[model samples]
Each structure stands twice: as structure tokens, then as C-alpha cells.
Target: MKNHNVFIALLHYPAMAKDGKIIITSFTTMDLHDIARPARAYEINTFYIVQPVDAQRYIIQKQIDYWLSEEGRKTNPTRHEVVSMVKLLYTYDEVIEDIQKNRGTKPVVVGTDARPYPKTVSYQFLREEIEKRERDFLIVFGTGYGIPPDLMATFDYILEPIYGAGDWNHLSVRNAAAIILDRLLSRNRC
Candidate 1:
């Protein structure tokens, strides 16, 4: 029996900009390969990219289809396995519905941010809690300055920002998602 159920979500709209404005960020093509690799490696059940734009969604779908193609499979067999886990969705609610349909339950929504905020759940605590419950989780990564306050308010838990050697806290969402999975899902890599 599987003891863990985890999903990854990338929120492109309803996110923030450096100027503290809410904006729709463009989807980064590299993130499909970069982030999906970590999601597959870390055993996440689903890698979801939530973008509402029609053109952006079309492009992402095409890319995903390519990765599922014979040429894509021949180009890099390993990445093909990873990309197979991706699911393109239009919004957060759709993600919930998909998980519920597949997993038979709604997932607890977890989020991450670069801002140093108190009352954030520690990675250690979250890992232990996940081990204790038979619950599913949707861990969301923001596309810009991080998901805005209103969106953050909807998360069941928000993980604390990861720190580097200096005061630098900003990390590309792809890198941040990878680190979060390593810290929370795997044998302590630190």
C-alpha cells in the first residue's frame, strides 16, 4: 500500500510581480523539463501546470504531446518517463477535482513563498505530519514574486522560505520546487 500521496502545482496567474502587483506570468518552457524531472524523481503523483491563457495552454499542451511522442521518447528516454507525469490544467479548482477523481479525496493545499514570513510550517514538521496521515497534498509553487496574499490565504499550509549562504532568498520556482521536494519527501538530503 502506498503511504504517501503528493502532487505539484505551478500557478502562473493570480501570482505576484516584483513591483508587488498581481499579474499573469508567462509560462517558462524550460520549467516543463526542469521541474517535471524533480516531480518524477521525488515520486510526486502529479505535476500540474495551471495556466488560464488559451495560447499558453495550447503551447504547453503541444510541448507535453511532443514529450509523449516517439521522437521525444527517442531523444531522451529518461526525460520521457518524467514528462509523462505532467498534467496541464486551467485553475486550482480543476487540480482539486482531478486529484479527487483519481485519489478518491480532496487534497490538502500547501504552498511555498520566498518571503520570510513567520507562522510557516517547517519542512521537518510537514514530513512527519504527512507520514502520520493518510492524506493527499497539493504543493503549489508560485510563478512570480510568489502567489499573492489572497491565494496564500487559501493554502492549508505555507512552507517557510529556503535560505542560501547570504541574504538572497529569491529562487527560480523550478529550483525551489526541487529543493522543497528533496527536503520534505526524501531521506534528509541535508
Candidate 2:
């Protein structure tokens, strides 16, 4: 069976700016390609790109259309496969609704961040929870500074931030998604 239980969303709206204001962040075209590759590798069947602007959504949809087209597939079949998993939505609520419809149950919503939240859960705990395969999970990842504080509070579980050897902590959303997926779903994890 397809592993449609675990989903990841890349949110462009309601993200925090450096000035600490909620804003709709601009989409990075390559983020779709980079993040979708890992989502496919991890057997995650649905990848959500949440953007509220109509024009931005149109541009993204256009790119998706081309990738799903036969000509684009001829150019790169692997990309076509990866891009096929993307589901465009306007709001975070819509993402939840879609997952619920697919799984027949409300997913245990999880949020990702570079900072710790009161409800933050360890990767080990989440990995084991996902392994149970009894409940669906939707991991929400933000595009700007991070998901706003008010929005982050709504998630059921906030994953502990990924930390490297050094003090620096910022990671591109695409890289973060791959590492988080490997940690949660990889069979050969050490």
C-alpha cells in the first residue's frame, strides 16, 4: 500500500518575518523540486504547497502542469514523478481537510521549527509514533522566518529543532525536510 499516512506541507502564508510580523512569504521555485524529491523518497504520497495569493498559485500550478506533461516527462521523468505528489492549497486548514478526507481520520498535526516550543517532541518519539502506523501525521514546515507563534501553538506536536555540531542553526526548508523524513521513516537509520 502507498504510505499516504504521513504528509508534509510547505507553508508560504502566515509565516513570521524577520521583523516578527505575520506575512505571506514569496515562493522559491526550486523548493518544490528539492522538497518533493525527498517526500517521494520517503514514500510520502502528498506534499502540500500552501500559498494564499492567486497569482503565485497560478505560477506554481503552471510549473506543475508542465512537469506533469508528456514533454516535460521526456525531459526528466524523475522530476515528473516527484512533482506529481504535490497538492496545492490556499490555507493550512485546507491541508488538514484534505488529509482527513484521504485518511478517514483527523491527522495528528506536527509543526517544525528552528526553536523549541512548549509542546516540542523529540524525533525519536515521533519516529516511533509514525512507526505504529495507527494515526496519520501532517508535518507543517514554514518558508520564512518560521511559522508564526500563534499558528505554531495550534499544532499537536512541535518537533525539536535540528541541531548540528556547531552553533549555527538555520537550515534551508528543503534540507530540513529531507533530514526530518530520513529520521522519521528511514529503515536503515543508525
> How do the predictions measure up, each by TM-score?
0.93, 0.97
lDDT (C-alpha) at residue 13 in model 2? 92
Report the Cα lDDT for residue 5, model 2.
78
TM-score of 2: 0.97
RMSD of each: 1.7, 1.0
Show pairs that collide, candidate 2. none
Question: Distance from true position, residue 119, model 1, in Å?
Answer: 4.4
- Tell me, by TM-score, which candidate is best: 2
User: Could you give candidate 1's per-residue lDDT for residues 81-172 as a string of tens digits?
Assistant: 98999999988789989999998998988889987454479898888877776789889899978898887887888888999999898889
Write candidate 2's Cα lDDT for 62-158 as tens digits: 9999999999899999999999999999999999999888778899999999999999999999998987888999999998899999999889999
With a 3 Å backbone cut-off (N, CA, C), the pairs that clash in candidate 1 are none
Instruction: Report the lDDT of model 2 for residue 168.
Output: 82
